[model samples]
Target: MTTNRTVQTAADAALWLAVHRGWHVLPLNYGTKTPLRGCADCRAENTDHTPQTCPCLARGDGALCHGVWAATTDASVISRWAQRWHTSVWAVHLGASGLLAVDLDTRPGPPPRHPLNGLPWPADEPPPVDGLDTYATLAALSGGTVGDTFTTDTPSGGLHLVHEAEPGRWKGSHGKVRDGDDTVRTGLGWQIDIKAYGGYVVLPGSTSKAGLYRRSSTTTTPLWRPDWLADALARTGHDRTATPAKATSAPAPVATGGRSGPRRYAVGALRSACTELAVMEPNSGRNRKLFRSTTRLAGMVAAGWIDRTEVETALAAAAGHAGLPAGEIRYALTSGFNRPLPVPDIRSAA
Candidate 1:
């Protein structure tokens, strides 16, 4: 009698590989794409009006509060988690890992006509999944080189285009774009989503009930995001011009000529902070909002896009204007900067 067999890589093995590659990893539940839930304390705190400001997150304690916030490149920690849950799938936090991904859900068929211009693909060749050809056309129109960008194929036969997550860019969800009027519109047509900051994507070599993820026709590493793609995506989400101007007093002046480039970075921090604050309810818990907003700002600092002190000054003024108390704002900003994140290679385009 013959036995049926196939090679299968272990989940932890995937984690080990990703962590070694400098990607900060997070754990997904066994056989599912969802992130493992936060600890009991974090769960309880979610009931609060300001769930975003969970104290456990700011403390840097042992509790795994926000799953994305818990992403790490630490080999020991990755190995420990892998050992604990052999079935856990591997995921890389987008912004923390300095990577971004475009999710394209497609189906086998004649590819749809370009949505914007209604041009058809060449009739002689077998068409790619629906919507993908459209995206390729759009990317080309936007002056991007989509042909060589690293990509992955999902279990159900969709595609993921991986690129560097540029600082000062916003994330999108399931093709939804939030307008300045607080309305939502369909962006990237109907089948694409841009996952950037505050997002995560499953790594290749991970398995689930759906199936395994595999690299799609890519031999090169993921590249720096093409500016055209970023610009096209920015229109779909919170672009710099889309954010409301801060009504708060100006931030304290920062010294010039440091490694962090305090003054220059502060402008980006303020712009990012204003985007966060503009969406919140005016009376929401200041600490929670501060923590959430500062996380992004601190990432800018950590990425060498800005200075830590610059972020601090900008956030303080933003928080104060939003009615958050002085002490709590300080605590939240400090805790946010102190929180763990993947230290990125600012110089590397990959």
Candidate 2:
């Protein structure tokens, strides 16, 4: 929907463009990236109302109640929000819009001594000074180059490389690479963050305290992320879900010490489920497959044949590899865990 001629503010124009491009948007506080707070009643410290149950939200009178969850593409909502928060900055919910942003920030202070530690960096080349350099080095390492894309310049002199992604395919992650001891190693170099599922990025042309976020690319169309880059990101541990616990050792056997049949069956079933999940296409019944797999494995968990933590970690990894968003994966796992356990016919098991 076209923005009314009376609403000629830069924020309004950005909101209109984002809505036109099918992006879900919400208003942030003026001169800041923070989402506008909820209504007075909702903001009360002792209030019992949640965003979902708030009367203001139900009546469509509170457009900025739940942060990104309040984001919508409805013209009326956008107009109302723009009118109410005239100077507010507009932000796009990247995942809801099937978009991803590589946020390359410019940090103050001297560069790290060993930014790209393991990567092959030429002795003649200068060390990376910012996120752009880090991304370039990472791209080169992956045998790919940072070609043209829909790029934006942040007010703080950072870059946002906007790319198109399949909906529910990726989740947000910071650029921190950790070691076995949980030591921090290099990640996407430094100052780089991913904004995807469950995250949002400010709209271009919106102004913040530092300055305006301007479009740097000639085209508005975003390019698909290169396969090599995706692989590198996976290797570097981006777009992954955090596991609750690590499986350091095999789960202790259940009390039926003499009977190994059910345990063997559960192990085999878990392996099969993970294998199927890892190979499924992102949009081709992946969610349903995950739910079924989780349900089956959850049955094994209930039977005391496998450790619940192990099952969760393995299934989450497989689902993440298959490009399922973390939120969706968690939902599937939770739903499966709540269902009644299936009776395993273990007559043929070892």
Q: State the C-alpha lDDT per candidate.
A: 0.59, 0.68
> Which residue pairs in candidate 1 have backbone atoms (N, alpha carbon, C) closer than 3 angstroms, thus clashing?
53-288
Q: Among all windows of ten consecutive residues in candidate 1, which has the lowest summed lDDT? A: 1-10
RMSD of each: 18.0, 14.1
Best candidate, TM-score: 2
Candidate 2 stretches greater than 4 Å from native: 1-7, 40-62, 117-124, 176-187, 240-350
- Candidate 1 Cα outliers beyond 4 Å, as residue runs: 1-18, 44-62, 107-129, 176-185, 217-220, 240-350
State the lDDT at 332 in candidate 2.
67
lDDT of 2 by residue, 207-233 (tens): 766677788989788888877667555
Candidate 1 structure quality by residue, lDDT tens digits, 1-350: 11111112445544554655567676777545776765765653456623357676555432456677677676666666665655536677787777888888775433333232212223354544455755775676456767566677888877888787565366656642233322123445435677777788877767767787776754536788878766555443334334534346544443443344443544554576655653455434344556756765677677666667766776777665665445446656765676634544434432
Maximum-lDDT candidate? 2
Q: Candidate 1: global Cα-lDDT?
A: 0.59
